[model samples]
Target: MRSLADLNKQGVVSFGEVIVDYISNNKDNTSFKQFIGGATVNVAVRLARKGISSTYLTKLGDDEDGVFVKEELVNEAVNMNECSMTTTKKVCKVYVHQNENGDRIFHSYQNPTPNEWLLDSEINSHIFIDTKVTYFGSGTLFHEKSRRTTETILELAENFHQIIAFDTNIRLKRWESAELCKKTIAAFISRAHIVKMAEDELLFLTNTNSVKEGLAVAVKWAIPYLFVTRGKEGAIALHNQQYISTEGLNVTVVDSTGAGDAFMAAVIETFHDKGLPQSKTDLEELLTYANGVGAKAVTKMGAL
Candidate 1:
């Protein structure tokens, strides 16, 4: 069997929701700042920017917001032929509220929204089959319809023998209960070959405070590699019974909004374009590239 590095070097196919972020920096702001965002969509765009051929699969509405998001992806040269449109709801919007500590509190509106209620017919099986890597985040698994759609995509990806990469992008407020979020995310975790999780996510998914104990639980699912992200402390990967650590690039903190997404994008692009994960040298090189990308993302306000 070919390794994940070989598969990623071939290219990638990503599936998830693409949302228009309606953000505000002022308390009584007359209008909000809009940015094209969504975890998988950002990954696809960044991959394209890095000269990787990327296919983005998802549903968007025919509304103005949706048009803007699609146009942004098109402008970035992402392959969006697998994307669909529904005229029912406007695009998904995320309203951001900041606390005194500068931590963002998101108020999202999504319930049977056009994108969330995607039909399986909207996606093309051939696209999934042709891609070397199929990536997605757990955010889209909250709703029943979209959850089912995500599951179907995973099944098709397995059939196509694609390398399945999952990001444990747990959003507590999106689900009805923390228990439910853990359960659903575990289902996807069991299916992924490569998993990217944060330090806090280790505690949430495993109910443990230690990364080692958390990794023990994650390894039980037979995931080949696990990357644990430690903000500013850098990232560590547990693979082949060795710990590969990389230090973060020192940079001014403007907004930490899309740093992780940027890092994920860099890793995926490196794997797809350069057949990485072959050696520790390759891992270190990619980590260095990702650190640069992540640091660059914070200089901007939102995901592009």
Candidate 2:
């Protein structure tokens, strides 16, 4: 059986924001639920839940919220060798709104946290030397120190036989301009071995509403694998000169907060299970499994 520990032993390191997700239920008077989140963090949790030994690299304030976040990571069994508490900024929080259609919108509160906090530590490549895969989120690329840190890490790992995955988890409100977001995200996509873009996200990034056109653009940039997730309709994946589509599972939706992250976790798990460099048929299976996991995630209130 493929185990999370096996993947970890081989090497998997996730670099991104680790935030406290403050979620509110649209039903039952909009009660709140707090969960440890952020895109890569959510994927790391799911990987750990499946027995993968994963390490999360991010910063959190040395406060109650930070305590909660750390406790959650420990409970999930994610490697925290590089995680640290920052005295400079409080932990970031994302407040989410789940509409009746199960779509989620979010407002973020940031602390001007710098990526130097992580680089200044003992994060030698040897610690993640075994890591065969490195995952990063686009949000971190918005800040210079953090973006440079992520870029440097990827540069360092380039010599290693590793697949670099980038999730274009765009937050336009966090950037200074739309042009900057597009430029930075496009640059990352051009280099990523695997890239995931939502239907709406492609429209925003490419300024093109057509999926075919957007994917064509992605292909022109030389991205090896491109996944376009269309909410409700399902997701389409392109790999190795073939296109495969997976229909979304039918389920009662509550909050769609973590669905995409869940989908990502499932993709990684399936890829790890099948071993490196999957065929088109293998890609289809992975996308189907990921969609199921994503559908199930929306049935709950939080990212967990």
Against the true structure, whose lDDT is highest? 1
lDDT per residue for candidate 1 within 102-134, as digits (tens), equals: 655565655455435566767678786567788
* Residues 21-74, model 2: lDDT tens digits: 778765332667777788999999999899877878877667786777788788
Which residue pairs in candidate 2 have backbone atoms (N, alpha carbon, C) closer than 3 angstroms, thus clashing?
A: 4-51, 4-52, 5-51, 11-131, 11-132
What's each prediction's TM-score? Answer: 0.90, 0.90
Error of 1 at 49 (Å): 1.1
Q: Which regions of candidate 2 deviate over 4 angstroms?
A: 1-9, 27-31, 100-102, 112-117, 120-122
lDDT of each: 0.76, 0.74
How well does model 1 score by local distance difference test? 0.76
Candidate 1 ranges with C-alpha deviation above 4 Å:
1-9, 26-31, 105-116
**Backbone clash tally for model 1?**
2
List the lowest-lDDT window of 10 residues for candidate 1: 1-10
